[model samples]
Target: MNQRIRNCAAAAGLLFTAMTASAANYTAMLTGPKEAPPNSSTGMGAAFVKFDAASHVLEVDVAFGGLLGTTTAAHIHCCTDTPNTGTAGIATETPTFGGFPLGVTSGAYSNTYNTSLAASWNPAFLSSHGGTTAGAESAFAAGLASGAAYLNIHSSLYPTGEIRGFLTGAAPPVPEPASFAMLGLGVPAMLLVARRRRKA
Candidate 1:
């Protein structure tokens, strides 16, 4: 491509990236016996969560193993005063994902939720937050960022929770205005280099 076109394309790409960069990712390692609360039996599992601000979607994936009995239910619990401690005040919809029964002793769980879809959220969460979809999402996101969220798996043997782990990760930082300017300025520099090379 010619220098002019190349630079213009580069500039456009940078602008596009800056406009579409507001997603967050997080992970939790669930060790049943390791982090189990008092009187709970030991088990192990893992959970992953993704949140996209632009799409207003929250995705969850989980896997469990070594439970003493069949799984009764599972959920992403949150807003604890401390990380990995205290009884979870709110929980996501049970079974996390549809089509998967909570009876499996070892298996995977997956669920996709749109923050605007009130049906996908726990009723208690909505009530305690703002009784609205946006309100619940905002509160949940804040808790996640502060490490107050956690994943909890319950079983027939332990109705409360068999294993658990706290969620920990930060959202992607917003790009500074100067960063955009630097990116925009690079386009002209590239164009100048290309022009010089062609002349030589």
Candidate 2:
């Protein structure tokens, strides 16, 4: 009985570890009202971000429309003093993200950045976060997880930001087939252990 319990516990531990090792995902809904010192602009947007800690890569996708003025720049800010409010400096590429549409009222963008490279980060942000790519990655990931990071879209009319939203955790990616196999084995073992204990 004791050995059976130990086997079930080991299987459960492996299942939990496998699930937690996957990448992290976050999302935001951009709007004028979410910006600091809110504006009356009619623009709205949405951003989806994914960070893979194993590979040190970050993926970003954004879509926006209905702006009062043409777009100028877009990037991410991080480590705000408070979550869901306040403002912070840029943590991503300066001026704007690479390949971002300029002088456009509405557009869509998708890009992947290698966080292990200095070019993917703002110089000031890297310096402030311990002056290393690893340090910057750690800090930025923490900010996103804590709701202290945001995606901002600047327009000609609103230089500060026409629309912005704080990043929040999104639904996790689908588990791999191996994960399901692990679950299948672990759950039955757990159930068997429980049945034996009840019979006893």
Best by TM-score: 2
Candidates in order, TM-scores: namely 0.72, 0.75
Give lDDT tens digits, candidate 2, residues 119-167: 9999999999999999999999899989999999999999999989898
How many clashes (backbone N, Cα, C below 3 Å) per candidate? 3, 0
How far out, in Å, is residue 111 in model 1? Answer: 2.5
TM-score, predicted candidate 1 vs. hidden true structure: 0.72
Q: Of the candidates shown, which would achieve the greatest lDDT relative to the real structure? A: 2
Q: Candidates' lDDT values, in order?
A: 0.66, 0.81
lDDT of 1 by residue, 1-200 (tens): 69999999999999767645655667676655434464445456556677664677887766566667778777778798876577666556644545544777666656678878877778898888879888888888888878888877777888777777787774223334543243343323433443353233
Return the clash pairs for model 2, or none.
none
Q: What is the lDDT of residue 159 in candidate 1?
A: 76
